[model samples]
Each structure stands twice: as C-alpha cells, then as structure tokens.
Target: MTSSRLAHEHDEHVCPRFHRAIELVGKRWNGAVIRALMDRPRRFGEILEAVPDLHDRLLSERLKELESEQIVQRRVYPETPVRIEYALTQRGRDLERILAEVERWAHRWLPQPSKS
Candidate 1:
C-alpha cells in the first residue's frame, strides 16, 4: 500500500485516549449530567431535578466519579444546612463544544426519544 493509504489505514484503528474519553463521556448518564451542569453550578437536588429518572444514590456516585476525574468541582457553603454545589471545572467546560457537536449530530441522525 502507498504511504498515504498506510497512514489512512493506521488512523482507522481505535485510539486508547479516544476510547477512554468515550468511556468517560458515554458512561450511563454521565453525558446527561454534564450537559445539565453546562448551564451553571447547581445543588445536588437541582441536578437531580434536571436529569429525569436519576436516583439520588446514583447521582452521588456519578458526581464522585466526576470529582475524581477533575471534571466536576464540589463547593461547600457555610450555611445553616451546609449547602453543597457542583460545577464543571475548566476541564469539564472544555467539553462544551464537543458535547454540543454530539448533540447536534444526535439531533440530525439519531432517532428521537419517544414521548410517553
């Protein structure tokens, strides 16, 4: 095969970093949760409300995962109830354009969710 064909063939192979990124972003509800937070910082309850059918326990787990990845930051406020909020870090916000493109592609090509 020619060098250009060889290069194209090589590029067809899966990339480890790209695979890791897809796993992170495409994990169950991770994309939804991140998209919800794209607007602004939100309390745990608020995020729960934004994402339908997300259980509190699972949300907690997902937030912790994101936190570990440095994609989400948790903040504590000194209040009577000790309020906590979650916001996307710069790393997470950097995903906005990518996620938005995915959103657009989905809208164009993916089947629409059924209205129940």
Candidate 2:
C-alpha cells in the first residue's frame, strides 16, 4: 500500500476518543483560553480581563472543564495574600501548533468588516 493510504487506514482505525478530545478543545472559548495561557500563566481575574466579552459563568465553566481534562493546571500560592494562577499542561501545549495554523487560516480567509 502507498504511504498515504497506510496513513489514512491508520486514522480510520483510531477510536472516537481522540475525536472527542478535539471536540472539547474545539469548543468556542476553550481555544481562546488555551491561546491566552500560551503566553504565560494567569490568574482568574487576569483571564477574565483578557477575554472581556466572555461571561464570567462561561469562563468559570470552561476553566473547570479544561482542568478536569488535564489540559490546565491550577496553582495556589501561599503568601500574605493567596494567589491562584492557571497554566497549560503538556497536553494543552501540544495544541499550540494547531492553534497557530488555525490563526493563519483565519487571517488569510476571514474578511474584516467595514469601519463604518
């Protein structure tokens, strides 16, 4: 068989679990949250500010879901004032290349609206 066919056959045999993962990451706000964390770890409020238009409830839900999926890590610092920050896990970092590609595609094909 040709290499291309072999690759396609291999993908065909793969289970739906992998597809489910993609679906989860592909959820609307999930990708943005991952992209934001790609820059650096951020606190809840910092993420909220970064995604100003996102509703607070939705952000909380997304963060919790990502955490449950082992895609994000929540760290709490013990100090005079407690601090919490969210950072991407190894699995989440794996999305960087994919996200970059999507961004490139959007810039190339998605049109900008008129200023008026």
Candidate 3:
C-alpha cells in the first residue's frame, strides 16, 4: 500500500454535528447576527444597525432561522405598540467562546477591510 494512501485512510473524521454547526453559523449574515446579539438583547432595528449592509428582508429571515434552531430567543412585549426583542438562549450563548476564538484567529490571519 502507498504511504500517501495510508495517510489518507487515517485522515481525521468530521463529526456530523460539527458539520451541521458549521453550516448553520457559516450561513450568510448568520455569524454577524449572532455576534450582534452576543453583546446583549436588541430590537430588530438595533440588529439591523449593528450589521451594516444587511437588508431588512434578510435579517428577518435570519432571525426566524435562528429562532427555529433554538439559538435565539425572541420575546414580545404586549403593549400599545407591541415591542419585540431578540436575545441569545443558553445554547446560543454557548457559542460565545467559539466565536471569540474565530475573532482572534481572524485578527491574526485575516486582512483588515479596505475603506472605500
């Protein structure tokens, strides 16, 4: 048997749960939305402002997705105008360390964005 083929056979296997997680967080704007909420609970408008270039429709979709995933908690206040806030659930908050590590890695290896 070839040495390279033996090495390929012994390659580290990817966990299905981890792969699903990457798909979830790596979705467009999902990471940014999660990061925004990591600070604290926020209104819909606040999240929009926190993530520049994020469109209203897209944000709505992302929130619903996160909610379905049980990563974000959406609370509604019944009042005259009715208010809503989005916060991270414990499951979501659990991602803070992972996100922070990604942030650190980015800072070290990724280039800064060029101002237009």
Candidate 4:
C-alpha cells in the first residue's frame, strides 16, 4: 500500500474523533474545571477558586456544558442554602491520565515565562 493512501486512511479514521474530543474538552475553562474535580467534588465557588481568573458567568456556562457532555455531574443538596456540588463522572475521570500526559508534554515542549 502507498504511504499517501495510508496517511489519507488514517486521517479519515482518526481526525473526526480527535477534532470532536478536542473541541469539547479544549474549550475555555473545561480542562481547568476537570482538573479541579479530579481530586474530589467541589462547590461552584470552589471550582471558581481552583481555576484562577475564571469568571463566574464563564464558569457557570462551562459547568453546564460539561454536565451535558456527561463529563461532569451536578448534585444539589436539599438545605436552606441549597448547596450545589459538581463532580467528575466516570467518563471524566478517564481523562485524568490523558491530562497528566498532556501536562508532561507541555512541561517538556512548552517554555515557561520568567517570573519577573
């Protein structure tokens, strides 16, 4: 088989899945949110705090998106304050290893800015 034909076949098989997964998880705040939930469940405020500089509105939207994607699960406690907690679903937990690998790659290839 020709190399160009193999390349084309591989792209046809892999590109859509790769692009779709990246498009979902690579959205702003999505990765950070996932990272925050990796340790344990968190309240909305905690997620915001875990992810530095994330806006309240953006965090809300991202959480909703992740929930819809089945990556994040939302639970509400019945109480006076009606606390809401977000946790990673099994699907989301599966990404932890992937994220760690990405982190390793970034540490190796990406240059860090000097702390001035």
Q: Which consecutive 10 residues in model 4 have the weakest lDDT in total?
A: 10-19
* Tens digit of per-residue lDDT, candidate 4, span 46-96: 998999889999999999899999999999999997999999999999999
lDDT of 3 by residue, 1-116 (tens): 89897677558676588789999999999999999999999999999999989999999999999999999999999987999999999999999999999999999999999987
Query: lDDT of each model, Cα atoms only?
Result: 0.95, 0.89, 0.95, 0.92
Which RMSD values do the candidates have, in order? Answer: 3.4, 3.0, 5.1, 3.6
Clashing pairs in 4: none
Candidate 1 stretches greater than 4 Å from native: 1-12
Q: Look at candidate 2 and tell me the lDDT of residue 61.
A: 95
What is the Å distance of residue 81 in model 1 from its true position? 1.6
Q: Roughly what TM-score does model 4 have, to 2 decimal places?
A: 0.84
Once all C-alphas are superposed, what RMSD does model 2 give against the true structure? 3.0
Candidate 1 local lDDT, 2-107, one digit each (tens): 9998689678997688789999999998999999999999999999999999999999999999999999999999999799999999999999999999999999
Better of 2 and 4 by TM-score: 4
What does the lDDT read for residue 11 in candidate 3? Answer: 81
Candidate 1 at 29: error in angstroms? 0.5
Give me the overall lDDT of model 1: 0.95
